[model samples]
Target: MRAEPESAPYARLGGEDAVRKLVNRFYDLMESEAQWQTPLRAIHPQDLSESKEKLFLFLSGWLGGPDLYVQRFGHPRLRARHGAFPVDDRARDQWMACMLQAMREVEMAPELYVHLRDAFQRTADFMRNR
Candidate 1:
């Protein structure tokens, strides 16, 4: 038996298209859900179309794909960019909820789904400023 070389889960999960789908689902949840509507609605732009695209591109590079975000938006100082918003625990949790819902919508392998969800949860927690 041979051990398979470790692969980036992002690659195994289907790259850019999959990432875009996930972001789209996330935005959909934010747009529709009342729990997330207050804080998210205030912080997020009136139009989330660009937000979805930016998040997709940002995730593409963050997940080890081509550096499209940098090419277009320069450095992604995530914390800095988000600093302007009041991201308390509630806000972070709502963000995670949206992301988790989005992950569920994607047809990823179980292990891949767990890994991605955990990673997103941790990152969302880290982004909490309050």
Candidate 2:
């Protein structure tokens, strides 16, 4: 039997395509939005292609779909991987702002939005190294 939508965020999110759209929108906003440019975008490399792909893979598994990131890149080690960057409250907030905007722009369900907003906040907070 198929997993219930409530039990599977990936399905609730419309699967891989929706996830990719959210990731792409997040990165696009980070790249284009003035508010995120310094705190969030500056920390990323000039090209966002790989960053976009990695986030997509990571979120795919994180949302209870295929574990593509682990399959391709092993454990996420999110904090450690992000340790090299100068992430702080500002960066975290800015990142969350961009993601929240993307989620809203994509019209995610209210319940899922609340769930993901809280979860993303915690993860973004955990990524802070400075």
Candidate 3:
């Protein structure tokens, strides 16, 4: 029923709607699973509303959709942006676990899930500052 071009991860993943869902699910786990994710969650504001919007916008561009994040906020110097957070090895692993849980809950396709898991793991690790 859809006519999206091949190879666009954004489209393949169901566009903005799916991306938003993924972001929401990721944050939900991060909030709900506080026992293990406390350190990572602490880096965020008490209210996650802004964080959700930011993640949605960033992912929209990162996934090959319209460049909403760059258009609105300029280049995503991700490392620089995240430098304030104390992301050590534990934080990276916990973040990856939260993301994997989110992807599974959102029922991502097997191939896409694997691809995203690997990519997210690398990205999460890259954010480690300690």
User: Which candidate number maximizes TM-score?
Assistant: 2
Candidate 1, residue 107: lDDT: 85
Query: How many Å off is the CA of 121 in candidate 3?
Result: 1.1
TM-scores of the candidates are 0.89, 0.94, 0.92
- State the lDDT of candidate 3 residue by residue for 4-122, as single tens digits: 46577888788889999999998999989866556888888999999999999998878778788898999999999998888888888888888888889876578988888888888
Q: Which ten residues in a row have the lowest lDDT in candidate 1?
A: 1-10
lDDT of 2 by residue, 54-100 (tens): 99999988998888899999999998888888999999999999999
Candidate 1 all-Cα RMSD: 4.5
Clashing pairs in 3: none
Task: Flag regions of model 3 displaced more than 4 Å.
Answer: 1-4
For each candidate, what is the lDDT? 0.82, 0.90, 0.85
Alpha carbon lDDT of residue 44, candidate 1?
93
Q: Order the candidates by TM-score, highest first — what do you get? A: 2, 3, 1
Q: Supply candidate 1's per-residue lDDT for 87.
A: 92
Expressed as tens digits, the lDDT of each residue in 23-116 for candidate 1 is 8888989989988987877799898888888898888777777677888999999999999999988888888888888888888889988888
Comparing 1 with 3 on TM-score, the higher-scoring candidate is 3
Model 1 pairs in collision? none
